[model samples]
Target chain A: MDKWYVGVDIGGTTIKLGFVTEAGEIVTKWEIPTDTNNGGRNITIHIGQAIKSKCSELNESYDRLQAIGVGAPGFIEMKTGFIYQAVNIGWKDFALKDELEKETGLQVTVDNDANIAALGEMWKGAGDGAADLLCVTLGTGVGGGLVTNGQILHGVNGMAGEIGHLTSIPEGGAPCNCGKTGCLETIASATGIARLAKEAIDKNPQTTLANKAEVTSKEVFEAAAEGDEVALEVVDEVCFHLGLALANIANTVNPAKIVIGGGVSKAGDHLLNPLAREFNRFALGRVASGAEFKIASLGNDAGIIGGAWLAKQG
Target chain B: MDKWYVGVDIGGTTIKLGFVTEAGEIVTKWEIPTDTNNGGRNITIHIGQAIKSKCSELNESYDRLQAIGVGAPGFIEMKTGFIYQAVNIGWKDFALKDELEKETGLQVTVDNDANIAALGEMWKGAGDGAADLLCVTLGTGVGGGLVTNGQILHGVNGMAGEIGHLTSIPEGGAPCNCGKTGCLETIASATGIARLAKEAIDKNPQTTLANKAEVTSKEVFEAAAEGDEVALEVVDEVCFHLGLALANIANTVNPAKIVIGGGVSKAGDHLLNPLAREFNRFALGRVASGAEFKIASLGNDAGIIGGAWLAKQG
Candidate 1:
């Protein structure tokens, strides 16, 4: 019988699930709405039933499922698989692995969603064949994941890849959601870019961005691509901070590859070309050219793919 | 007959060698001048001859030497043991390992001096049982070594633990030897402390430091200990920057312990007390209490001891 692995990515709004093969190919994938009410008490039941239904729909036996891996947003105890906190899902101090295992009668593994994504990239995406990779996701907030020696770097408190919280500007950096000032996330996230564009437009109403009723990070990149002075300045400033942050991390971790993912990364070369240039300027001369930069290729499926990889490997 | 390992710590001014037993005890140790003339061409020859002579003096045959480990200041090629560069000793792209191996007729291992020191600490010093540790040597310039999972973190270009290069102040920061401005080394190193004291005295001529022809880091700490206002400010600033840098790294690497070494570390609690307070203030709530701070205990013998550890484990 062909063994199968299942990956579950539990997010605030939706839970994405994928049935994957040992070869890292996703056999099938789907999503279910997340019920965050009652502190996510019904989450395990939903996941268990969904897995059973999905297996039945594919005419596959439940015994064929070799393992289950979950990617959740928060700090997780690696040994116990207990979630210390998942702010988005209201899962505080919950035994997610044990709960899911009991509900489905299957062994389960759990990790941070960002970590699994980096693992996914290393397994079959941009980081293919590379064991040491740093993946930064620029969504509403910036989240970073590090894969060293083919394993996630879960620091003492499972906060190892919290690069978003690193003080980028130190002195006058914008406030972050994490109650800090001048964090990398305050400038590198998609929301952060929009905020910067809004600030710049407020200062000078002559820029093309001033015409937009709602300025977005994508529009800022689009205008910069067209050589708009203000937009270009904004992009340059963003790249400077992001590149500096990457260089600092490179000097510390010396990763072989830095993979950029998230909605903002859609800006492509307009983002990568300048980022690479600035990264070199900040990095030590010897390490400046050591790491290769690449846009993440797995898209939205990265979470599920990464979770499956964990299950397969575990 | 019990076998022994030879550890060699190669510095710009001196070469320290030790004959260590399997239990990590140094039976005997000695030092010799480092002949850097002709681009350090004769360093390996001297090391080999010294090792042979030392064995003869102890009435031990060459057959009793099981392995040899070398600790040099540079980016070492892990597999080949080729030194990419060691600016102080003027060695660039030198095969120190192969030459010494040929002369000694034994298997050899090589690593960065700071890394070897960290290994030594982990094996027998402050980081005695901790598998993950970040050891920083605050000498003229800051050098860091990371030991993760009982192994050195030699990044893609051997730049792992280059925490000294991390930007401490993003704007109007001091220029660094690494061709950057406002590095942690610019604020936390022995030279950086003296520079800070000098700048403070220059601004406020009434301070006692202003009368000194040479303002040393030790004097600044001593004055601070005595409640000298200007010196206290300098210490505060230094602690703030060093603490922030450590907190940032703590969030990223999350090592079990942070061991402080080098000449500047001699200040003891005068440095550690303020640094701990600031580190907690900047670190994420979860990671704030995760790491323990300790003074490096091996003193100058750390290098040779670390080299022996590599020889024993390699």
Candidate 2:
């Protein structure tokens, strides 16, 4: 009988789950809608039921499963797998690991979603097994995960690798959801790029961006690809700040690979070319020489894959 | 007979050596002039001879010395202990570890000076045994070292903790020795603080600073303590940039202890108070909450003590 591990990624809207082998291959993957009712108390029960039903449908006994690894957003006590608060899931001080283990009758490990994604990339994605890696996810909000000496840095309070919250604008910058003003998330994330485009259009409605009903970060990159001045200016501003922030991070930790992922990264060369130039300009001469940039190849599978990695480690 | 490890801190002007026990106590310490003549070729030979002579003077056999650890200022290949360059000592591509091992007939370990100082602080100084720490030395030039998971983070190319080279004033900032402009070294170092004061004094001849023939960083801090408006502004500027840079670093690594050291650290509360405020202002609320700042207590002994730690590890 072959052994299997369950990898779960819990998000606000959906929970992604996968059955993975010891060698990191996903046997099968699926998603279930997150149950936020009753303050998300039913989340673990649903996950447990889903896992059992999937195993039965595949004619596999529950004994074939070895352990479980889970990824969740927000402040986590990595050792205890306790959630101090996960605003998206309406969970506070939740014993996620204990509950999941009880429900599934298996051992479990838990980590931050961003961290697991970074681990996934390190194990099977753009990280290429580099011992030191910096993975930035340019989603609705900028998210980051850092691996130093081949291990995740959870910090003193599990708040390590909050790269998006780094202050890009020291004064009079836009407000961020994190209660800070002018954070990198306010300028470099997907929403930030769209916001920049909106602000530009508000000032001068003469550009090609004005033709769109609502400009997205994708449209901004598209316009820049065609040499639109306003779009180009916005891209330059975003890359300059992002580049400077990354350079500072590189100076601090000196990672060998910087992996860019998430929806905003879909712009591909249009983003990488400008961002790389800025990174080189601001990084120390030697730090720049040592780092290589790569687009994340794992895509949406990163979270589940990363969750699988945690299980594999266990 | 008791065993001992030799710790060496090599500088351009002098080399500090210590005979340390396994328990991290320095039995005796001394200094010898660094032989920078002949392109620093004789440095290792001098250090080896000094260790042997010191043992003879103390009526101890050289056999009692277990191993040696050396700290040098430069870009080092941490694994092989090879020096890429140390401009102050005129050493380039020097095999520091192999040469020292051959000269002394003992195993040897070598690390960057800044890194050793950080490790020393962690072992016996202000770090208070914290596993994750950030130590910044604000001397003639700023230097930094990072300890993660109770080990020094040498990074991919041994350039991990280059905090001083982080770009603070990303645009039109003063040139740094590293060939970058607007580095944190240009605003927060002792030399940088003095430079800021000189520029301010040159622009306004009627200030209290004009009364002094020379305005060093010390004088600037003293004047600020006395509430001189010009000096106050300079102190504020330095702390703001320093605090911001530190906050960014904290955001990345989330250190539990941030140890500030070096000549400029002598300003004490005059520097710590304002710098702490800026650090809190710029750092994420949680990262700020988790960190405590302390002045480095080891002073000049940190380098040799840290070097001893390297030998102890060996």
Candidate 3:
């Protein structure tokens, strides 16, 4: 390789790996299904093989290779190369970097998946040219990352961007999977949207939604598009909570812009317009003018692109 | 002629001046009464005279002095150096830096009081060596500063660190001077403490505090220490709100440490222990573990020292 690096985005269902160049561009990328029941070490070996298979296809005697960068979920101890309890992977104190290195013999640098994805989004996506950026992933759960002064900030033990767990309502409300009530994720993520829809269905059984088998947020959105009252109610609540939570996040970060991505954000202006109105109402009037709320553009490609950008920095 | 900087800390009642060196130490400092009603130009002349008078006493040449750094209570419009709105001084768009330069023949840099104080504390006080720090000034009006990777964050329009205005309650709990209702400042600041004490006195007029002509937080703390039930109850409410506010802040910044200063911090363990306990209940598990709360070590001197430190950085 004249000059090349690798970027890995590990999620619950699939692990996306990319071969990238030095200018924050993705040359090639591939995805592999993740089977965590095979154990963490086996997963690392598979990821290494995926990287090697892609690098070999470049078809040149490599002069040198830059470092490989990884975006991981859960608490990644940057110094120890350990994953301290990744919930989706069912891993605790997992020797992630060591296992990957043992299989591929390449030095690895890992960070919280959201942090690197934010870097990717900032360098190439909606946050481009912004110095202060906050990127939030509205997936099965809410993931957050903060970038200030052109650098990712991780508190000691890599727990800096835990905005999902921020208390949205201190009193009794929806139960979060994190074993906490009143968490922001309990009210705004894809899972949270599904929960809100399910609750509405249970509370109002006469709605057309009850006639359908197996409720999904997508179906709810589709119903709302067709003018179903219950679905519209569910979406309005989601936007309301999301708006308040965004306002709170704005208060704290005062970032130039906030980028929202993942499955739920696909609701588009139906979700965004109300959220903008609410965030403005709650955000301090002085700094409220600075923050721009936008739906994240990269979608599924954010991981590879973010990885490529981070790898360039590496 | 060695490196010399004049550090000015302007408050409602006094303007503190210091000669600071490049090593972040205040060699000598003095305080003079400030006349806010006399206009910005008069204040500028008073500061210059204070600096010149100090130089004459030490037989130090005024020509050796570098630029001045001012920590004022308000919004600063960058190098133009106008006071956008110093509520304490009733100033709005006053050209403070230009006035001072013309009067004293020296260049100047100006910033909000809380931001400058945080810089001072970070340079030499409780937050020394902290890569991520959030300082909350617990005064008549609560204010804050955010430093990530050793840089002060000033959001668009220089209003980034308005933590005091973050809504703790959704609406209509108590009114704030900023025209907001149920803000964190309404329940957790020194003015808040006085209000809480006043409420207690109204409820339990038979208590010893009722005899006092003018009640203050200091008197309430004294009464509580003397085993007054109403005083203790009011204090407990303050602690609870303070904890919830800090927990919310912890979720946002995820700082390595939170330095509590200004007058109310003097309550020490009497307030800190309860606040920490309540904060634990509200903060996310991972983030709460990453940060420690501590009383600001620089105490009353944080403002002066912080201004001095900013001068050195300049």
TM-score of 2: 0.95
| lDDT, candidate 1, B101-164, per-residue tens | 9988988999988998998898889987687788999999999998866788887778889999
Better of 1 and 3 by lDDT: 1
Query: TM-score: which candidate is best?
Result: 2
Instruction: For model 1 chain A, give the 10-residue run with minimal summed lDDT.
Output: A281-290
Which has the higher TM-score value, candidate number 1 or candidate number 3?
1
List per-prediction Cα lDDT, in the order shown: 0.88, 0.93, 0.77
> Candidate 1 or 2, higher lDDT?
2
TM-score of 3: 0.87
Better of 1 and 3 by DockQ: 1
| Candidate numbers, best TM-score first, in rank order | 2, 1, 3
TM-score of chain B of each: 0.96, 0.96, 0.88
TM-score of the first chain of model 1: 0.97
In the range B183-276, model 3's lDDT, one tens digit per residue, is: 7788778888888788888888888889999877777777877888888887778777777767776776777778888888887877777778
Using TM-score as the yardstick, the better of models 2 and 3 is: 2
Better of 2 and 3 by DockQ: 2
Which tens-of-lDDT digit does each residue in B208-290 have in candidate 2?
Answer: 99899889999999999998889999999999999999999999999999999999999989999999999999999889988
